[model samples]
Target: MSYREERRADQVAERAQDREDMRLKLEAQLEAKKIAAEEKRKDSEAKAEQTRRDAEAKRRQEQADKRARQQEKERNKAARRAKYGKVTGWLNRNPVTAFVGFVMVCSIVPAVISQVGALADAGVFVLLAALLSAMLEGTAWALTFMGKKAEDEGRPAGKYRVATWVTAFLAAAVNYWHWSEALPNQTWVAVVFAASSLIAIYLWDMKTHGSHGKTTEERREEKARKQHLADRRKHHKDIAAEADRLLSALPFGSIDEEEAFATAWRIKMGAEPGLSAEVYANATNARVALGAAFELGEHVRPELVRAGMLATLYNPLPNRLSEGIPTLGPTLPIPALQRSSGAATALAGIGMYGSEAASGNARENASEKDGGSTGGNASGNSPRGRSDEELEALLPKALKVAAELVAEGNQISAAALAKRVGIRRDDARRLRDRVIAERKLKLVDGDDTELAG
Candidate 1:
């Protein structure tokens, strides 16, 4: 009985053990499946992340490539511009050669295109025409250049200029004739083209070389010449102003005759008297008028001043007497002195005399009394009277008297000078003024006599 019971129990126990082993195997298989699915998901995520990184890198490389291409394009453009600039600069310097080359290219290329079948003949003809045009233009340019050069050198450019104009007209006519023959139906178009070409060449020439072909050296010289002229004009103006000032400063009163004579000499020698002949004449007239006024005991008149100036300029001495001084015996009457003086003749010439008939009668009477011609006493003096020779001859003596007056003292008046030199008061005043002006002396403000150099 014990063996049978033990066998049954053992069978049951074996069945239970088999059931538990199957459950554990199924659970392990399920757990392995879950882990495999998680690993597949992680691998997919990693691959996706790698693909995004690759795409981003590719996008960045493409942008860099685009920027590099743009930079390269800019560099190429700049290089081309620099090369073209150099070529243009060379062409500008050699305008004739450049124009010839341009003409040849334009003519030959067009002929080649239009006469493709007869290239050899058409090319030769086109080249010939271009050469002719270029030569004509060159001739004009040469003539202009030569003329400008001559003008700059101060030589006559008339011949060269005439040749240039003639040559230009002939060239233009020839071009028009050639265009008319080449494009008979489109003659107007050809004329316009030829004219435009000519104008272009002229404008180009003007741009490269000035119209006058003025070189840098010539321009500088012209500037210098203008400056020199301006300086000379200023100098002349200053001299004129100084002369006017001196004339205006003269006192309108009686001056000693000796002083007046001395002053005239000083003015002629040292006071730049002839800088203005008009001013000198005016001063002489004032002196003579002042003397006359003093002698007559009257104020100086405008008409008398003008008459005296004319007399001094035209006739400095009396016609009857060869010398300026009268013999010191008795004072001559005013009418007698006037009739004998050449000053009356000058006054007549200036239309200042009171009556033409009176002057004529006086001259006739003098001529009869002197037993000489109407003008002079068998001297070389003209009918108008004696020249300034007599006055000029007394210059030395007057100069000596002036030196003595200056040596005497700066505090001297016209009256004192007249008494000392034994001359008229008006003449003395004139002489004192002449000496002061010639020496560039400064006059004392209150004292009319005192002067300092």
Candidate 2:
């Protein structure tokens, strides 16, 4: 009973195993089919994306080409406009010249031919009369052309211009006679004929003379340029000749006219253009004189005073007292000093003490007696304290003198004030400070404490 039951159980287990294997095989086949379908879908999506990208790139390239074509068209249009603008500008500027030329060619040729042909009808040789008319008008036009050419070249064109007018007048007279003879009752026709011949020539002449609708500013500039050129030629004839020589020596187009003139002026004048040795000397002298006037009181200021230069004034005596200008002697009294102070100072000590030394010494002795010692005062007062008191006494007078110097544009220093008012340098410095504080004046360069004595 156990063997039979075991064998049946084993067969049942085998059948169940076969069914499980079949189920797994079916699941694997379904999974493979799903994977293939997913791969095909991904490939289709990739192809679609590629097509879209290609379409976008092609559209962008076409748009870029369109923009390039449009830019090129606009550039071509602008270039055409510029080309037309230049031509129109030239035509606008020369309207009168163009009009006159057109009128002369259309009217003058026919009128002159007919007028001379009238002479042929009066038994003159036809060919000879035509040739004579052609010669008259041709000669006038030729002279006009030559005159304009000469004027443009900056040459003398007056004679050619006059010849052109004379020839035109002769032609007018011939036409006048012909018209007057042909239309005896209509004498105005003779005048009209005469005017027709002269009008074109006159307008052409005016155009060449720069009166063809030029503005007032243009005319003024032209006149000024002519005057300047004339003045240069008149003042610098030698340089002008040298310039001409140099211009002729060099290649025709190598050097500009003004450049040649400048070179020639440097070579011939031995100085800068528009300047001479005498003029330079005069200017230098004038400048030195002005500087010297500014330095009149500066000699007393050792720091501000320049070395190796002295200022002097040439004061003349009154006309009532002297016959001519009075010269300064070595020991003569200075008028500038006399005006500012009542005393006469020697020129030798004018920069230093004037007449203040004796007063300075007496005050020093008095300060020594009152200060009670030979040494400097203990209150930071140099020398004696009484000297400061004496300086305070003289401060009013020193201030008056300082004010006068300031009015004359002189930069006041302690030394200059001390010399003027017979005071010590320290007292003078105190007086200067009082003046500055009271008057609100700026501190000048020469009054440095570093340079104070």
Best candidate, lDDT-wise?
2
- On the 0 to 100 scale, the lDDT of residue 78 in model 2 is 91
lDDT, candidate 1, 39-85, per-residue tens: 99999989999999999999999999998998999999999998998
Per-residue accuracy of model 2 over 313-390 as CA lDDT, tens digit each: 333433321121122112212333333231111111212212223233333333344333322223344564235566
Residue 381 lDDT, candidate 2, scale 0-100: 42
Question: Measured by TM-score, how close is model 1 to the native structure?
Answer: 0.27
| TM-scores, one per candidate | 0.27, 0.38
Q: Which candidate is the best by TM-score?
A: 2
Question: What value of lDDT does candidate 1 attain over all alpha carbons?
Answer: 0.49
How close to the true structure is residue 145 of candidate 2, measured as C-alpha lDDT?
A: 94
Model 1 worst lDDT window (10 residues): 444-453
Deviation from native of the Cα of residue 364 in model 2, angstroms: 35
Candidate 2 residue-wise lDDT at 251: 92
RMSD each, Å: 23.6, 16.7
